[model samples]
Target chain A: MTKTSTKPAPIRRDWIAKSLAGTLLGFTLAMGCSGLLILATAGLSPGTRAQFAMWLVTPIWLGVLSGCFFFSSGLRAWLWLGGANLLVFATLLLARPA
Target chain B: MRSDYIRIYKTVHTWTGILTGMALFIAFYAGALTVFKEPLARWAAAPVAALEVPLAETPALIAKTLAAHPGAAKGFQLNLKPTEDEPARLSWVEREEGQDDHDTLSGHHYSATLDAEGNALVSESQPSQLAEFIDILHRVVGLPFDTDPNRWLMGVVAALYALALVSGVIVLLPTLVKDFFALRLGKNLKRMWLDAHNVVGIISLPFHIVMAITAVVFAYHDGLYALQDKFLHNGRLANAFNQQRPAAKPAPRDPADMLPPVTLLERAQALSPGFEPSSLQYVNLAGPRAMVRVWGTDPAALAPRAMGGFVALDPWSGKVLSRDFLPGTQDAANTTLSSFFALHFATFGGTPVRWMYFLLALAGAWLFYSGNLLWIESRRKKQRQGEALPGQRLDTRLLASATVGVCIGCIAGISLTIAAAKWLHGHVADLNAWHWYVYYGVFFASLAWAFWRGAGRAVVPLLWLAALSTCSIPLTTLLAWAVPGLGMWANTSLAALGVDATALAGGFALMWAARATARRVRLGAEDSVWSARKILPSCQGLS
Candidate 1:
């Protein structure tokens, strides 16, 4: 009854792929999310907002990475996460004071 | 949600727990006790030396200490109304300037106390680091081939731990509200364990999440702080990784200009009404940035950072530089974040909350242990069609031995070493070094014994050892008092008394566990390795 869903073949391959995606893509998403939070609270005191931004960094990163497991396949998880990460990163790039 | 995803997540959860369960158990258990580090340190202190000074007397002590050890004039912390365990202690780090290498040689920590004659008397006695050593085991586990600092490996573990939490929640969500709380405690031991595990786990989900996030930050906060300095302060990310957070440093103050310790406490108290001063941190005493930060506990606040409140005072002018984190002074966002830290470290709701965290931590440890046992039970392979083999599979035996060795051994090692703190105090050359020797000695011995005698034979004896070592903490304390002239406050100070009483209770509990396990091994399950009766007769094919 217990040995049902987790087949052995694809697991050896996909786990590594999923881990890499979580590290790279999840970090990108986390960085973007934190930046966006800082920008959103740009009106607050700089120190306060910055501390708040610092506080959000870990949860957002871990959250994004953990959310990756819900996807049907490792490749799909990678693709969707990568796309969202890019969208956020690009938005931050354009919105920056450069 | 698809059923396949549940299976996948269950796989994820199981593997993650298997990989990280042992370390997390150590961390939670030790972390629970770390909250009471002050009390333990106090209990370990020699009765004669456990004296505290009032704030009014600190200025004199500081003056005499400065006059005696000129190095401390540069910087030192004048500890004030600290916890009962620590009293009016002053400390400083010895910085060796002008080393050949770029990094300043920073070691030689000095903690001094003033004598009755106002002479600067530095304490040469060593602390057992009993609490700290456990904390290190929690934080680092000192696992092989991980990382040099071990904190980075801890961060990676924290990340995996976070993933485990997420997956566990999802996997249990479907029937979480229905059967998660149902305790079917009849014949099905596995069912009972599963119910208890899920119930405790889900109840503490928020606490676990806070630990995961804060652990990640603590593991790599310096780098993260540097990252912020890079991104926000018109700095480069390339330079950030190599640099520390920039300090708002100014020149140090002259010796004559340094303010009195009581004045700093008064200023802190004035800034935050009803603030009970804990300690005073004097920084850059020889430079322009010479400021004394008075830390305290507010009667009305629960901010994290453990100390609860802070007020920085200028050494020269004795003027308040910045004041926040007190009961009335904290800004909203900072206050909110501090509460999260408070939750992470169990700093809220005082002693009651601490006791709750302590129970929860032990429960958390049990969850992991029972999970391992369940795995071993489930994976026992069959020798014939529909017939079970009495001997456990190789994998089960290996895991069983490791689980008992690592978990029970850790319990024994920490307990005995802590118990040794009193006897080894003045007799030992280095009291702190003896702590390491005692812990490693017992730890490896237990491990070797477990692997040598096999799980069924070793469990009872190892547990008895644990019970003996743990109970000895209180026994030693009471024993000292039994000698007429050797009375120390063995029965006073509820916190100190509580520690000993709790240890004694834990010892009794372990004894009960040992007896129960022995019973289980002797009479239950005819084919199981847990039954020594079965294992003894079926030993021909086994190693």
Candidate 2:
């Protein structure tokens, strides 16, 4: 990691689009993550599992939202988050209780 | 973090804060007052004649009261220690038909006691809703009602607030170590404001984080439960919580056969020596699953709910049914879960913790207020030494007016309404409705006055108004004692007197603020929106 004189590329701030991406996609991602949690904790009592699932959504959603700006562009954010959402939801569907 | 990431986070923090600052200001301010909701209710409750029913006689009273008012069989309370707010031995509330379950203020309250002849003396009562109303304002960000839509709006604000907090921390990360404790007080006003904001924000970061997360959960818990039911519990979430189901065709039980109040209290205290029983709530007393919840607080452990934890028991058999919510008796998992609620409600550390939360909440409110001030100050168009000052931006002026209006308006409105609880009790036909009117009237009038007169001219008078309104709280108590013919009553309890003392301090603080703000408007920067020398274009020649 040698120091260089060249300036780093300017980050594009498409705030509105990125905000929409974070809000809409971040929620689905939270649901998917919590869904996976529900599947993993299926052996726990129904009440406990339900409590865990319900309380888990806000923190996950906020985490994704807070990290969304790290992506260089809104489209990149949407793409990466959309891909992660698909993977998690697919895993959740396959592993859900019968 | 890269400079660009920091810059991005700064923007995120700014936008999120500007969007939710005013609403959060109201929430935190009202929430500070709500920490003492019980005391406020006690102070506002009209003194009633003593109706002390003996503990041994409660069985007969319950039997007769149930015979006369079968509606209370579904749920009712036996007040073990009746305060001014709950003056009778037996009390219950019946919700109006089709009323929302969350709307506690609109319920029909009833209380019962054994008469001299052993007959149940039942009466309808209207408890003062001043405390409940402020709690509602805190919950729904100053909304008049706690409806689904309002709660969802609160959820959005809470979510944005969470984002603001995180991004604010990220933005301050570069200077975190250097400026952590800096409170540069001299001429650089922006530096001073930033330092103050950072001090409060960073010191209370964990508190704000918990509040933000818990507020979002509270706002959307019903919907969250629905999601959990759909996904995790196969629509049996409620059934899972209630392990025992009442028999569909079970025979009704006799209320008189239940264990006496003394036995119930003894049973509860046996489980935990520190548990102080305040009331016994009987749910489904006539049905097969008749249970009595011994509700109280334990100073040593965290309460699982705002009203404190309870031990549910079978009234007839004196068998403990559930100790999940019993504070000191909870298991590891239950204690861990209850800690969230306890931390949010300040129910773990007793009165000292409550006072700490009250002061922290007020500081949180000041954080928002100073954030807005920093915004306006940053946008100020400084005048050249030899030239006339450039006009401040329209957006900044408008924001200045709005900030003063909404923030000071809430302060003044809440203070005046609290005073109204004592003054307008019997004078108004519906005192609860008058609380709403008085609050919104002051709030909107202050807003209109600020926008009309501009922030500089309106701020001083509004602060004075806030001061006087808050001072009226103690003044009302004084008048009630001094002038007995004025139809006002006062409670001498420490809880009630504490309200007067706190309001007296708050009123004088507002006076000092008014004086300081006046000085700033007259002699501070003339190139700012808070300057008295700057006249609006429309009123340029009036003076």
Candidate 3:
């Protein structure tokens, strides 16, 4: 890292696209996780489980949303977050009560 | 490859901040005031009763209330110590056939008690929604949408805010240690501004983070609850996340021998030492199965909740029904979760914490504002050697005007509306309506005024207006006191007077801001967007 000469990062539009993907799509991914939490916390009391579900929602979503910028290419960010979002939503829908 | 990641995060940080800064400014500013919502409510409430109805006479009053409004017999609460505006009030919501309890607007809020002539005096008046309106502005930044009250929109803004926070940290990581506390106050205006912004931000990082996360959770709570119900509860998702209550169902009891409100409060103190009770909530006032819930604060409990404990009692039996989540009695998890909300609302540490949050929230607002100014300043075009014309960009001009318009407008709006509370009562069918009108009218008018005169020159007038509006709060209170016929001197508690004093202080602050802005416009850098003299050419765009 020391060998690499540091230069000011160039402002670009592609970063904006990645941020949008991370925010909108990453939220869906977090919702998927929130949905998935239901299966894991089945044994806990209704109160405890609900608390965990609520407490987990924001940080998890924000984490992935912020993480979205890690992908160098906007296309990769799209494919990665988009795929995860699709998978999560599908699982949530399938898990819906009959 | 590494640089690309940095570049990507930098872009995310900049654009997200620029997009959401204004909204966050409004939210933080309004939210800071909302921390003292109880006092504000007290200050704004119009006087209904001259004296507080004694606790001993409450049961009789309840009987009286039910005799007149028979429907209230089902479920109604007697306010133990109602605010100054409503002394000894009893109220219940009139719900449609199958309306949910959590929904606010679905039911008619009905309150009744005996008037001066011993007759049932009932008011079907709209409950004050002024503080809630400010809260909405804080949450959503006044974004437009179809839903009358939409939290999802606020949730989105919270998400964006969270992203900005993270990306900002990442962008700052490079020079973090060296420039962390530096406040070089030399010729570099941007440096000084940046230093102020960064220092304030970094110092209050934890507060901002907690608020951001909690806000997102609150805004999207319904969706999260629904998700929990769908996946976790397998469809039986009622009252899962309402960890706020001690118990959903109170023990059954006979109404004939119900314990008095004082006795219940005493029992609560006996049950949990160091717990100070605030209010008692009664259910089933005129039935055999009456229950009472007492709310109190525990100073020892962590900073996350107000009224840290509760004691549910069977009215007739004088028996303890439930004591869950009581400050001394609550489990670790409940305490922890409650702490999160308490921290966001500044409930813990009492007045001291609230004061700290108020100042920090103002600093947070300033950070966003100075961020916008820095952006406008950075984009100012460099003048050539031979060119006499001082260069300024169109976008900078527009953004400058808009920034002043919104920030100053909200300040003026809230101040004027608060001032109006002194005069608009009794004469108006609904005082809340008058509050709304004053607020929105001043807010939008300020916006129009800003754009019309241009942001650079408009600052002086707007600031003066803001000062006057804010100063009027205290002035009106004093006037009412001076004029005996106005009847404002009665029941003006220290807390209510404190609101007036704070507003007076705010007005003085605004006057200082006006003076500073006036000076900056007259003598500052001619090429800068803040220089009012340079705004003459904008007439082309207007005419």
Best by TM-score: 2
Worst 10 residues of 3 chain B by lDDT: B534-543
Which clashing pairs does model 1 show? B250-B289, B251-B287, B251-B288, B251-B289, B252-B286, B252-B287, B252-B288, B253-B287, B390-B527
Once superposed on the true structure, which residue ranges of model 2 sit more than 4 Å away at CA?
A1-8, B246-249, B534-543
Cα error of candidate 1 at position B245, Å: 14
Better of 1 and 2 by TM-score: 2
Q: Which pairs clash (backbone N, Cα, C closer than 3 Å) in model 3?
A: B27-B138, B258-B315, B304-B339, B304-B342
Distance from true location, Cα of B413 in model 1, Å: 0.7
Docking level for model 2: medium
Compose the digit string of candidate 2's lDDT tens values, residues B1-543.
Answer: 799999999989988889999999999999999999999999899998857898988989899999999999989999887787888999999877788777777778999998788889999988899999999999999999999899999999999999999999999998999887889999888899999899999999999999999999998989878876786567888887887676586776678888998998999999999998889999988777789999999998899998899999989889998898998988876787788888888898899999999999999999999999988888889877656568889999999999999999999999999999988988889999999999999999999999999999899999999999999999999999999999998899999999999999999999999999999887777778898765555433332
Residue-by-residue lDDT tens digits, candidate 3, B377-462: 66877545545545578888888888898889989988888877777766788676677788889989998988888887888899
Note the clash tally of each candidate: 9, 0, 4
Where is model 3 more than 4 Å wrong at Cα?
A1-21, A35-44, A78-98, B93-129, B143-149, B239-254, B284-290, B302-309, B317-322, B427-429, B486-491, B534-543
Per residue, candidate 1 scores C-alpha lDDT tens digits across B94-213 of 667754221222246676776777676776434346665665666665342223367788888888888888988888989888985687776666677678778877988887887888
